[model samples]
Target: MTGVLTDGPASTRSPARFVAFGGAAAVLLTVVMVGSLDLHRLTTTAVGLRRTISEYALGPYRWVFDTAVVLLAAGSLAILAVLVRKGITRWASGGSLAFIAWSVGLTLVVVFPKHDWSVGPSMSGSIHRVASLVAFISLPIAALLLARPWLRDAVWGAHARRTFRFGLLSALSFTPILYAVLVNVLVGTSWWRVLPLGYIERLLVLVEVVSVLVVAVWAIAAAQPSYRRSNTSR
Candidate 1:
């Protein structure tokens, strides 16, 4: 995988851009797709935000959602590839692995849409929910681990630490939202919906996107242009 990180013989500016762009794309694609959907019918009338975005996988234009998730998965792996090429540190390796696992979970969610609660849980929906929950949990852990090595990189020192701090804050914001999601899932109760469900979930999604993006964009910005010239350094 590291071998293929190169684009032909040239380094190509910086491949780290892929991760940054991919993170931005993930959020954008979801928003655009959901905006295109008929929310009046998709979301509950009383609780407009009661529905999770995953529920849209069953919509008429589900192809949009599916394609977006698949792209995100590929993008995540691309991120790992860049990190490996940059010189994998112990922390980076673990971070890369965690992100890869998160990508796989998203892939499964694409394969199996969320369950139709109206009809109760089927095997596929059950798998989807569990996958989504696990994936959500792993991303923040990855962010924290990935930040460790970057803090020590002289070339990327201050910027890396700043980005890491932002990532951690964003990840922390996701905790309660995730808990609300779990409550809806486990208790099968409408209590979670009592709050601004749509707002809460959207906040979580935004934080997740922001967390990933800060690291990715920082990676892009921090990439050493003379990497090839300084082959003896690391």
Candidate 2:
């Protein structure tokens, strides 16, 4: 908010505002890259929704996919830095650790491409699968934990409520994946074959990314002079 930038003392506000803006910009960059790729897919290629997002990496747009993922990881780290600096989250806290794990997992996902069934399973693919799992599972947990403390605060309560709900929604979106697993375990079929895995994954990602954005906005709010004074007084 402009108030955040203008109300605080210039010396303190300058650095905090810069970090906050940088974090937000990084997050926005991921959105831009992903959006452009998806737009191309939608209009030019008509890439089937049933195909997983990672499928992009197997095609000409591999660089775009990889860059988006790396940017997202970088954004997560920036968000964590802002939260830690503002004391909204501690470096050793569960929320902070979850965020760190999410960032690391995202980085690993970019480093290792998804398993190509035609090529058979490989170690890099296995690591990619595990990393994707960790990244998906970690972010909502981090958002929930981080939202908890601000749930009752007047200034941040609304934003916290939004983050908490989005986190829950993001968690719930994984139910189909769980169902796929259950079907695989019970019927001895491949897990990925049970559902529209691609669509479900995309939905899950959208909700999780939204949760992250909400928390980033909250961090920006926390950087405000009014919020800082209130927090200090408490």
Model 2 lDDT-worst window of ten: 1-10
Task: Give the clashing pairs for model 1.
Answer: none
Top candidate, metric lDDT: 2
Per residue, candidate 2 scores C-alpha lDDT tens digits across 1-234 of 111123544444546657776777877787888778777777776555777888888788899889888888887788778777776777898888998999999899888989888889889889999999999999989988887877876666787799889889988998899899899999988999999898899899888887888888877776655445324421
lDDT per model vs. reference: 0.64, 0.80
List TM-scores for all candidates, in order.
0.74, 0.89
